[model samples]
Target: MYSVVILANGLFPSTEKPLELLSQADKVVCCDGAAAKLLMWGREPDLIVGDMDSLSDSLKKRYSNIIKKCDGQEDNDLSKAFRSCLDYHPSSIHILGATGIREDHTLANVSLLAEYTELLKDIDCTVDIMTDSGVFYSGFESMQSYECKEGAEVSIFAFDNTLKMTCEGLKYQTDHVIFDSLWKASLNMAKSSKFVLKLNHPAKVIVFICND
Candidate 1:
């Protein structure tokens, strides 16, 4: 399976898990200013995407051949980087440096996970946003299963509040919960090493699995 890593210009990753993923990625794509951070970390990205505004002139000149100028103002740098990765036809995409620093930016980046999953639904590609504290996954299918550790922290957010869901292996049951609120089923814990989420219909859900 082909794996692609998209490094955004958020807080630079310092944790071992994210660093390990970056190092092992089949191809690494940097979002504008993130290229400098990746270079500082002593790794090079296969491609640098997004508008050239945040990149240094010297670095741009040096990596001109690998630099892809995406001048779309509608999409964020991370989105641009993600779209660029699709050309490589990756089976899995891991997003790093997507969270931390500004809370607004962090929230925006996390919410995009649902959109990314929808865009890749027909392609059968998995997408994840890895942070220092945890990893975020978006589910578009009716049912989804996740491997977890007993008592591990878990948070579930429904992109479509009207969507009903029932879950198994979670400390708190979501069968009777109303998802109109973002935190309606959040801060839950896993009761076992595996959990399953079954939705009433097709909907989008974002699941956060903590590293601890």
Candidate 2:
């Protein structure tokens, strides 16, 4: 079973209502004081992980199974949790509460996505971060959108070189077009209520270089 990981938010936003679907996860992990937020939501955090900075004493006492303590200022609790993931080897990792804070810290957390490729090696892995700007990630050809509104927008750039794209139903469709290797990613609009993108040629390619 995969584990849903929640990172300590320097600042929690009011718009995020992720708990509405929290029950879908097989297990829950709190990266530091983020455990308190889950506790406040009437949800029991399976594990309270990370250094004990923001995590209160009570939280530590209540859930000790996942309450892993790693003291370090060089990295945030999110980083610690990623390292700790190796021990459990969760099949899937869903990250919530990983947005808003010091711009640098937020950048650091986003940059952590790259370091995780080592963990993602030879495994199907993805990271989800909820933010006002919206969700982002790479990998996974068939993305099942849980909540993309009629007018809500999302943009995906090829991580490395441009991909040979065959968009199914976008406002501007591409039919086996070779997108550039080192160029801007084309902004495609959704045409049908739901859409899927399948890369043409090289059906078995993984790990792309992205500079967007």
Candidate 3:
């Protein structure tokens, strides 16, 4: 089992529970300023990878053993951590300090997982981000519509071709629905089932999220 924890820049309140979640990590990798955050929690990262822009002389002196300096111009520490993940191929990677940021940064970081789609698929690894709202998207796959109540919202999006959606326990049911692009899909919470979702492109990565 591969386990890696990455620390990135994000909202303070958003990182409140990171310490708790990160405690279970076998190996922790602080990304740039993320070390500072881990330090605030009184924890030392197993390996801190970044451009060295975020480390301080004081923090470096304290956790010198694990720090692995890298060139920032090439990629962010987050990317470097990903490379490490590929090498180690951990069973799971819990990323902290990655949510509730500038829309561009948040979007970019979230989508960053897409870069490792092949690696992730090969290892069947799941990566989840600990956000203030909730834990989500450790990985992706084709899912079928199931029974759900009305007023329940399911956000569906695709990285490739359309995903076929069908449901049983829903106020509204689609026999063989197709979803593409950045469209929001949800349930009213009025129904549910093992609603089935068939993707025309099963190899594609699909996203399902709950707004409520």
RMSD of each: 1.2, 6.3, 4.2
Candidate 3 local lDDT, residue 181: 43
Instruction: Give the count of colliding residue pairs in each prediction.
Output: 0, 4, 32
lDDT of 3 by residue, 44-119 (tens): 7777777778788988887788777788576667788777655565788877777665677777776676565545
Task: For model 1, state the Cα shift of residue 33 in Å.
Answer: 0.2
Report the Cα lDDT for residue 70, model 1.
89
**TM per candidate:** 0.95, 0.63, 0.73
* Per-residue lDDT over 1-212 for candidate 1, one digit per residue giving the tens place of the 0 to 100 score: 99999998899988899989998899999998889999999998799999989899999999999999989669898898999899999999999999877888899999999999999988978999999888999888899999877888999998666788999999898988788878888999999999999999988889999998
- Angstrom error at residue 167, model 3: 5.5
Model 2: runs farther than 4 Å from truth? 10-17, 131-133, 140-152, 157-188, 192-212
lDDT of 1 at 176: 86
| Model 1 worst lDDT window (10 residues) | 157-166
Q: Model 1 Cα displacement at 7 (Å)? A: 0.2
Question: Cα miss at 42, model 3 (Å)?
Answer: 2.3
Q: Point out the worst 10-residue segment of candidate 3 by lDDT.
A: 186-195
* lDDT value, residue 165 of candidate 3: 51
Candidate 1 segments whose C-alpha is farther than 4 A from its true place: none
